[model samples]
Target: MKKIILLSFLAIICSTTGCKKFLDKVPSSFVAPENYFNNEKEVNTALNGVYDILSREQTFGGQLPIRHAVSTDESFFSYASFPTGPFYYNFGADDATIRDLWRYLYDGIERANVLLANLDKANMDEGKKSVVKGETLFLRAFYYFILVQNWGGVPLKLTPTTSINNVNIPRNSVKEVYDQILKDMVEAEGLVKKISDIGFGGRVSKSAVRGILARVCLNMAGYPLNDVAKFKDAATWAAKVNEYGEHALNPDYSQVFINLCKDQYDIKESIFEAELYGSNSDAFREGGRIGNENGVKCSASTDLIPTVGFAYGFVSTTRKLYTSYEYNATDASKRDLRRDWAIATYTLNASGVKANIAATNIYARNCAKWRREYEVVTPKNKNYTSTNFQILRYADVLLMLAEAENEVNNGPNATAVNALNEVRRRGYGKLLAGATNPANADYPGAISLSKAAFLKVIQDERARELCFEGLRKSDLIRWGIFVNTMQATATEFTTYAAMTTTIYKNARDAAQRVTATHLLYPIPILEMSLNKAMVQNEGY
Candidate 1:
């Protein structure tokens, strides 16, 4: 379906933007917007174009999911020796990766604007049209949310940019951008289809909008904005999803990701994901590096591709993440199942056998959540795997609700504790819908913890459950502890790392480089040059 849409989009692009028809008078000229978007097909094509940006390499396709989100306490670049890069955080605004991410996100916004601006011209079923409009609005707001979260305040471009000359827009305040996001997303919730109606997690659904809205509110309630009122709003939105009665945690914790690797949608658990397809063994080049870049290390020359697809294994888990999962210091039976699944315990060797990583070397394990071994698309490309990267999940929604509820009520109410316990029960592999697991109690004595201690539990729970799914850095930033956390991580590396190991120096250096300035990425140098009213982020 994605391939067909993308191919159609390419055809439309060619027809409208100067692909030649040799028999025509103006063979390679432009087709004005007035002539296009006269039918539902045309408008749908344009909408798919906007959705395409979400899977671009600069966005969820790779950098944002891996490099941009890692280097935090959860994980780090396996090859961190590079002194300056997104992973190292020692780059300037002129850095190409930063500029590319900024451009891609804005490109998504612009595409959404173009579709929405011209949507009314199409003669389609009004209901279908409204859903399309709702999707576009949600996407535009989401693009802005990413911008605001990363750069603090960015130029809010709403209307379509019809010309190249209009480039000097002023930046909006963070509050203003967030307000616009809430307004658009709230309206979108009313217009978009429900997850059950959609039958998949790839496209925008009411639950997706509400879940992300809750996330946005949670962000506002923290860090720079510090809008405590938003906590209630966040809880309200999350409760809507929880109470929707359709979604639930997939019984097996690891199977949740395994389903993603196999391109199967468990809409019950995965609320939304970037639809990644095709291995590029054919003409469709839309696949992503979700598993390949972050999968267990496998060499093309040594490991047989047919047995275990090649993965550069560029990203690895931190000791902090390995230790974050609940486990008794001496007993193995008290272990959390999420730890081994989240962090690989073995790597494939030259003969394609499992080379188990020693228990002592926790930091050496790769992120195992998105393993490529289960990828069903055969003849897989070494650089790309057809693994759909989940953006929102029911477990995450539960955690968000618990966090926000705790904040709003000044303690963990029954609802909050139960919501949190659902996730904890799943982690211990004891959550069967109606069955009792007397052997593994839910949180043991969670109810007795004070508000402060419960908040700490929520924080650790999020890391243990959702590490390397690309929320850790933003999570730390919102908690107003990114710098302190990274600095402490550096101390840990200094304390635990062998003095002679390269990881000791590199990991410590990367962590130490983080400072107040890293709270938000810089406004791209290209944007600064074009928009005279734009200001660079502090210390950039």
Candidate 2:
């Protein structure tokens, strides 16, 4: 995966993040598909264009992770000014953010379609060519997966868009869209390389494909499409990753995220992540607001900026996430260590020093998972830092298997219990990657519990382990408890928690605004106006 330079428009433009802009434009000097991809080099260039979408502001780079994904039970937008935005659950079809997200996803799919349609034109080795084709197919399926989950059913375009005149297409059913996704991913499983061969988390690997396949199956088993049979398939795919024995959880829970911040690849723990590098200081605009938007709040003093970097800390942790971890009354080591690291207990002062936050002030703490102070890039930009964001990891795979196996068996078996307990052991600092465990943190009580009771454990454990990683809102929605969870959190903020007037209003209003319509965003106004076949989501 050559990630530094993303070339698009058939190699006519070469920029660190050029394909995002190229998608919206018809280059005056057009390079036809037949004119390019005459060699392996050109074929690889087209594949880079497909991967570039993951770095765009509309996808994993910024908007998806920072703004759209944070407003959940675990966290919320800290500022109170913007009442008509997706973060506050007050946006509509006319919202710019919603429009951009819809367009960029289709743009990524189009890139993949062109590459897949023209891959064999290049004179390349059969082995290498197959890998590229597999990657492109997986990416196309992944883009449609995002669309189907967010908008219920979007226009499905499989072939390349040859003309601007033939753009109006009808929406596919949710089941039809998911079937295509599974079809592509199941084929990709046999063609992609192993994580051990890649030795990095940026590119798609056999493990990544399997892990994400499990996730897609779990989504189908829940929510609007209650295909209960997919639970067995989900468990099967997740078990394949664990059976491979190539990935494991890094003993320390915080190090899994810190490895991402430092641009270090721990393939054993991190299965796949978005590659972000080089703040514009070096003339490459590839960096994103992963650290700046969700990190600890900092004053932009020249003295403090040099060491600690700058962050708006717009996303704040909620009391629900704070209390999810086990707390020991007197002993600190006996407690789960994830709470303090995921939720910031301190802020950086102007003097580049750590100022401890008071214990009573829980709601004001920032999302501390991706702290900018640990970024290794020199002269970091205030608005963007070179911090890569994790999309899939080994811990998530374990949890998915546990959840699926529970549903399939009507209760948790030993394999399911052990898979989940492995993550818990590391969260308690009882298990290291290779060292022998001195004490086991396995839940002895969970073994005898009913299926309903054990599902609750999986839910709380996911919030405790994977918080602020951009998966909470979707997880809540898939479980069919998103609206209830938001309404419950809103009541908790107003009735029980100690909060200031403005914080109470902002937090309560955002949660209470969620309705049945919010499960999926409405069709963007621009899209509806342009595509005659499009219909708006209900209650929008």
Candidate 3:
């Protein structure tokens, strides 16, 4: 229940002053489990190390979200020459980003393993010990989930790697890995505290465990697994979180993000997020990246300057996403309020003047979710803003419940319809009284639909609501439309290229690059080389 000072704790865990290569399996000499985890303070310190990895530039801090956004129809890099080859689906075994992502995830898993293996030795209170155990289990399951989703069956390391011999463990089957994830989450559900008791969304809680279980079950129900019965399980788990009643949608969609920038954790909406803090200098001194990667490009100091200035144009919303915003059929004046807040139509020039992007410039739109201007305290450096990266939210729970309910029942039921409408009501800025004027009336109420029709509507609604939040590609993959969607986007790019020479010619080429094999990333070249037992994914 206490606020952990992450920076100071990171200093304790990473005190050993050696820079090892990213994939090197050498253990740090200073904080080895034999020397650390001897006391309650030490065990808590080790847990901080697990949380620290989530802030790394290669993982949640930047690359992971950027990769997910650009690889899908939700976004793309602005410049033709931007080094986004992997995101374009053009990279192979030697891609450094993919390799870094693999290493970072495994590194976190290693920390969690060490903590779990030695927690019993620490002289902590029994209640606190259970909380720590639950958190570590959740963290380990989370890392494995990301690995299984991206790389398929990876080496499942359940224990601490005490020596070099244990490092070369072979990859496990996808089902085996998922089985462990589900097992860990189910155990975590009972051990962790409720969200209200924890008072912050950053820590793992009962609601967080249920929320992740719902997500994993949904994945099991779709795509390669096609375990249709899991749809009922997914809906049941998501509904449990709703029934808990500790989380709900924030009235103004924009304020949710504004609150995040100001370090006001919204337990009612943001269920879980990777906590980030300090200025750019703080990140540099502490060996961490400050904020998320998505933002507008700006020249001078403005409210958007701190967060958006560091944005390298590596990812921006696509035209497909821009046009997905729905409007009230009866009242032409009303439109989805999420459109402008999620995507920037204009940017500030060098002199701090607003400049409209040309209509033909398809790549100019930037994600506005990480605005720095809303921070109560100005950032010390442009690169580091204290905006936490939202991982799970209550809106997602409602939508997932709706989708799974439809899939299980073969039509939209009363429960599914109400859940779906609650999200829509908030999106139209009508959930909170006085949040919107009469001009923005309640979202033309929910409609009745069959299974097929409702599923299509939910897919489009997710795109409109959660675009640029790093979940788009996986959503498409689960729906069995990833390849088809990419091919269709490529066709659209080809037409845009004909109309304007500024657009990257290869944009169309890359859009068509996704194949069945491209669905999972190939084993990183370093991993394959280091562990001969590790086999590469199909198609290079």
Candidate 4:
């Protein structure tokens, strides 16, 4: 079935140019719905089209993650010569990146809608049909989730866009959009298969639906919605995944990426990921670009060789992120293993020797999680890579469970503490003997804190764990600290400016531009120009 799906996908891509011929013909040239979704194979082929949107550069491929990281304090453009205006929040309705993202998300939603509207009409097994319908619902809901979070309220185009009249639809309320998302998720949870049945993290499963539900519930429980009651629901959904027992944290965090780079999917740790198939030809560019955007620039032939000169030293880790790891009080050797693995503290010099980043060269602190060197086949073009971008991991599930538990109970409980400890234990390498070592070990012990204190801890923990993965901005927004955090980051940049030349000066200036108005990006100018009923977000 997988092979059939892959072949059908390639066929669709190869035949895409057929649309140009349709432009020259009359209305009769279009394929009718009855002719398209006729059987199981046709429906499956359509389903593959929906999945393909996720791999686009505007979606998970590049812009989405890059903009998310640069918009926050998690990362910065290493060189002032590179485009840094967007990182400084200088972009507005005319921004190309924002426009591309908006279009890509709606495109995904539309593809899902086309599949869903005709799913029941297809000739397929009852169980298989249900799986297809459920996957479409999950994909559509996921697209809306991203839209609502970024744009606040957007047009809720649920049905397949079959006519020109549907193009003028108005924007819905954030609450209305979220309501639809939760509805689809609830239905999807019951219809999707278990992870054991699929045997791959790329496909939607019941546990993935639950995990996303927990994430959605958390968003509702915060900022815009402020529905405190939803915290219990979040906890419930997260606990379900925790008890599912199919997913577990890989003991070695570094190995997870190594496996992904090798195109070896680990369903145990990565509950869901955007699949990227590498290729050496420009004609079939399907690989990921995260490695090129994040890896450090070096002149030596070491494990961390520089790829594209432009992107080689493009994105740099922020000082705040570099210092997020925990250190042993007495033992210098005992530190959070993820620190060096996740971020580059040093790089190979021209002599192939490790060189620590000095005050004069802060760009050396590049992100290492998506290193291109680990790829099984080195990409012919540095802009493309084979590494998969994880969407949801078991560690994220455990952390969400901890957060929701604390929010609902007004303090941490044994269940919540245990979940938090599990992640920390793995981060410290999960050694029973080392667990007791005060010098270098796991979480010191169970945490006891008030509601406010525990919530703060969870926020900090999330930044430390998920730093370059594109969740920081949304996390900060939900906590109602987006503006304040950026303001504080600006002050931190000033201190950093004192140690460097004009490079740090430009960064400090950009960081200072973050304000309350930036809480939600302006509704793209193009979108507003097209829809008369569409209103721009406040302070745009």
Candidate 5:
């Protein structure tokens, strides 16, 4: 199918890079500022260029999605162009992508600055200029957030077109960068009006800014080890998003994932999404990274899901998680229809659930999360036609709100509980799009969960709700229990019965426990080759 999509958005005083590989010696190709700001359209096109670069495989369209490679078992030595190879090695603090992330992001920074610097001269309506400014500020902060999260401290670039030559800039502490991020996003939060702009999917939005701010705060609260202040900040930002009232969870949870679903742009659940639409009819790529599997088999049958060996591996779920399904699943009323449809497992069929299908051809117990698509142009290529990557779902925001609020013990607060309940309600075929009391809370010695219990609930909910959406590993990291959980999950793969479970352990850990350093990926090799001044992190 020829999927039609256009990505652009509302803006006020906003605006927005690349060079030949050899000519890259210059920090940037300076176009005369006079000629640069020739028209409002010129500035708009400049920002479009930013979107263009980000959509490249090197950034979001392809390579960035593989971020799960380091976290999941669904990967192996890519016979193809492997962009994230360094991550698996536990590459140093200064790898190229790390540095390229610096450069690519700065490239965005300069573009945003250009717009902000020239906002006054723009010929567009004054209202439009403010919208543009809001967008630019959001983009700027968004890029910096990516930087600080990945590289810790990075030199801040507010608006330095005067000296593109300043390559010797020392790194700013992570805290400083975060401060800037907060400042810019805060401004963005105010300036962006509700959008009716064309092509808004994946474009920045008011709620998107709030969601990122909340997420950033949440990360800061947890990363580098949990800080009480960070938690407070996290809660505050999350609350800001909820309080601001720009979004809500859709009534249906599965509606969030199905490619065929409409109102995708209108779905209250999508705070932000990556827009992917392809209508190519080309032959399988020869030299270039065409469809961006990065030369690796993504969710390869044996690698990610459905492999008995991989299933039983420690990465597999414990009987604990499986039990969560037992509690929440609708299969008891026609069991397999609910759980069976979510995760693809080999089992025989029964009323409430399907028994594990007995078939050797069964690749593994895998998540049905992947959107398997058929080829359009070239018959050989298999594509996942889903246009929207649910990067930040509205339900997640609600649950996050619930977590932050509940942590303070203020209340499961009606609204917060509503948000959490909404997810389960949709999943279990209920109307209420919020959390509810577990049926017979005291029944049959229920798994007692205190405040911490919600954490596990969220984590398992991630498994059931997100699954193969390229989030589990990061969730594992953020939940702050990758090593223990992943290790136990890994060892579970050792037994015959466990093969269907994700119990396999990654050998990288030798029992001393994986360090927080593992969370930050090393900069790419290319970046180190380019910037000698860039310091490498210990243990490449």
Candidate 6:
């Protein structure tokens, strides 16, 4: 669907811009806007081009696999080869992944610009027009946000067309990118509507936009980059979500990832997520909407076993993170069932494997959070895994709100508990459907908290609730303990084993510990090669 639309965009864009069919699909020529927006289908096809860019792996599918994996200790990485697994796994910036990420995200920006610039000219149903326009704006902001966060200051291009007359540009400051992000969010918030729009599986919704706004503000509130003044604003955005009352916590943590993973558009806890689709009913795969077919891939997760990091066996877990769990053996044996969800941290089938079955061989603490949708088909389809990428979840919103409230109200207020406990209640199979803050136990005005003390709880709560969702690295960074915590973890984790019952090997080492260069990702080589105006990030 997206590929067909992209070709249309190329054909039309080339015809109008006098671009020779450099890629064959787009003819070198120029066609005026008047000719392009002749009808709704044409307008929609153009809009779909914006969606197509997102389907590129750099934006979601491919890049996610890198950012989510490299930024943490989910696996042991090797950095020996100049630009292969060894290079990237070692946090080296000159790798293909980094370069590809740069090209892909910018490609997304270009696609968005083309769609947005001509959207207003399209004569489509008002509702459909608004939805498409709103989604493009939201997605543009999203791709830029990824660039800003990962690449720091980046070239901020909101409009389309890069003719010889308009090619010169410079990297915008991070603050500028952020300001643009907020602007896009505000616009999107007004435009987004129903969660279930026709074929809008991954389209931005009002809740999703608001959710990202809240996250943007929350990230601004933490330390070195303390936009402390935004804490109140953050609370306000989160409160709007709470007041709107459309989403709520999922009762079971496991359910959040499994059965209910799809249709996460307006999930109570889901803020933003990347969408993946298996093209054919064969369930193998076409190509992802994210265009992941572009390159060589690495192990899906950091090693999960306690053995050798790259052996594709054990996915090691740090002992410190494992022991953080508080067990209550006296009561219902399922104390801290959330621990089970952290696949690399606990034993699932601890009993001796029954001798006759394959079940016994299934011993590893690695993340079981995957799917085997395809048995055969494309080569990549065979290695294809069913783990959907999640960007923002509501629990993070509640916790962020709790932190913001604790800051604004100056302590763990009843409101903070209401937000915090709402998430936990779901964990315990409880719902806040009709319950009010302060519960029945405490008076609202009487509760409060000290900033210092409150921050500690908020940090712990983030870890307890969002352990392996790829926020660990950033959370520690936000809290100012990223280096200390990660290094200590690697030390204690050196001898750690992924499974208790299975005897494993190879994971004994002190290879890729957190370092100074890790503060930011390096600029991709392709960006430098393609965009002469681009600059490499520090220490690449």
lDDT of 6 by residue, 216-315 (tens): 7776676336778878888888777655666667766766665322323335555455655443324323233221121111133323211111112123
RMSD of 4: 4.1
Error of model 5, residue 316, in angstroms = 10
lDDT of 5 at 365: 39
Q: For each candidate, what is the lDDT?
A: 0.82, 0.82, 0.75, 0.72, 0.49, 0.53
Clashing pairs in 3: 248-268
Candidate 4 lDDT over residue span 383-480, tens digit each: 66656778888888898999999988889888787887777777777633345543244344446678788777778778777777788888888889
Tell me how many residue pairs clash in candidate 2. 0
Pick by lDDT: 4 or 6, better one: 4
Clashing pairs in 1: none
What are the candidates' C-alpha RMSDs?
4.1, 2.7, 3.3, 4.1, 7.5, 7.4
Q: Residue 523, candidate 3: how far off, in angstroms?
A: 0.8
Model 5 lDDT-worst window of ten: 307-316
Worst 10 residues of 1 by lDDT: 18-27
Clashing pairs counted in every model: 0, 0, 1, 0, 71, 38
**Segments of candidate 4 deviating more than 4 angstroms:** 1-30, 82-85, 280-283, 298-311, 328-333, 348-363, 431-446, 498-503
What lDDT is obtained when candidate 6 is compared to the true structure? 0.53
What's model 6's lDDT at 56?
Answer: 50
lDDT, model 1: 0.82
The lDDT-based order of candidates, best leading, equals 2, 1, 3, 4, 6, 5
Ten-residue segment with the worst summed lDDT in candidate 3?
15-24
Residue 422, model 6, lDDT: 65
lDDT of 4: 0.72
Query: lDDT value for candidate 5?
Result: 0.49
